[model samples]
Target: MNPRLPEFQTATATDEQKTILNEILSGPRGNLNGPFLGWIFSPQLAQHAQRLGAFCRYQTGLPLRLSELAILVTAARWRAQAEWHIHYPIAMQAGLPADIAEAIRVGAEPTFAEQDEALIYAFATELYETKRVSDATYQQAVGRFGHTVVVNLVGLLGYYALVAMTLNVFDMRADGQNSLPFAE
Candidate 1:
């Protein structure tokens, strides 16, 4: 798919844009791609989003594995090819089961071996599919991970959903690969 926006170039960037790009480059992400490329159109928004995303992806209360699982679920729910491609390997590196990530990529319900993974999958899937999570699922998440983690989980979901929407709206392709595993 062709991108609706042009790629950001540092050579032509204004001072403010250069600052924002510098901030992103210095962060843990090191370099920008995917949604960040689109975000450069609004430097301030990109700055704030980068901070929030850093927290969600790195500092959230949930383990990296569970957080990546939630992200995978969000990517699958939105069929965000860029997101899936970017995070699939990270999810695997974080120790998420390969079969589970592949299942989510293919739009199948993954059978999770870990209870925490199962809970996160259920929570994210229920929210994405129905726009609301059942009380039982909510309570299970809260009981297991506490309210702070639950709040972070919801924030993570909403944040990634926004990223997915941006990637889809602008037709961002991951690493020049245009195919998505799941059907629209």
Candidate 2:
């Protein structure tokens, strides 16, 4: 069944609102959840908020590939089709191997480099299944990945996990496909 779209009272956008909406559109466009987003005019406040969130994901300085792995695990936890559809490729482009991406997408144990693969999967699974991470898990992550990567990995999981939920709420759709690193 088609998802129920949000029904809201429409009002003419004020100059301030328009400015905020435009800002939101500037970067981190976020997923466009269906045609319904057409209603959200870009505004400065929204843009700034989105930008800040994006910036925070980088606060840890983890390599981009690790960040994407964390995000992929989070996406699977949510079973957010659209979210996975969007990010699977981004993860690959960031250096995630195609086989690993598929394994994660299909919910299998992927062949990954020893510490890197297991660490991300364990963290992601715990977060998804339990909604919280264990201290031992955190310690392992920090021990292997270092402080910065460990923090960023967790943050990235939360960030994309939230993004997946938001996309579901809005019924977001993937824009289009290009060559993703994970493609067969």
Candidate 3:
């Protein structure tokens, strides 16, 4: 499937877009792909999303393993091929076992050895499935991760959900590959 939005061109970009593009290129991300390609159409949105994304992905109090798990949960829920394809290796490298990821991909309940993994999976899955977390889940999250981390976890999941939507709507695939990670 062709992407709904074509790649942005620096040569034809307005001054505002050029500045945003330059920041994205020079920033930690160092590339204009994924949602950035769609966001570049509106430079202000691109700028805010870029900064928020950096904070959510890097500055969050949640550990990388947990955050990546949240992202994968969002990807699986959204059936976002690009997000899963990009982060699967990162999640594995961060110590998430292959079986857990495979379970998520196949829409099965994962058996998590670590309590933290189980907690995050439950938190994310419940939120996505129910649109509101039960009081018990919220308290469990706060007790385990504290208030700050709980907030960050919500923001990170929200951001990745947006990323998943952008990828799905645009039919964006990583590296020009054309295969669905989760069966529809």
Q: Pick the candidate with the highest lDDT.
A: 3
On a 0 to 100 scale, what is the lDDT of residue 13 in model 2? Answer: 65
Which stretches in model 2 have alpha-carbon errors above 4 Å? 1-3, 6-12, 28-49, 56-59, 146-149, 177-184
> Candidate 1 lDDT, tens digit per residue, 48-138?
8888998898877999999999999999889898899889889999999999998888887889779999999999989988989999999
- Between the candidate structures 2 and 3, which one is better when assessed by TM-score? 3
Each model's lDDT comes to: 0.88, 0.64, 0.89
137-172 per-residue lDDT for model 3 (tens digits): 999999999999999999999999999998899878
lDDT of model 3, residue 164: 94
RMSD for all candidates, in order, please: 1.5, 5.1, 1.3
Best by TM-score: 3
Quick one: ranking by lDDT, best first? 3, 1, 2
| Per-residue lDDT over 43-111 for candidate 2, one digit per residue giving the tens place of the 0 to 100 score | 443454465456644565766677777777776666666667766767788888988878887788887
Error of 3 at 142 (Å): 0.6
Backbone clashes under 3 angstroms, per model = 0, 11, 0
* lDDT of model number 2: 0.64
**TM-score, prediction 2:** 0.72
Model 3 pairs in collision: none
Off by over 4 Å in 1: 176-179
Instruction: Estimate candidate 1's alpha-carbon lDDT, on a 0 to 1 scale.
Output: 0.88
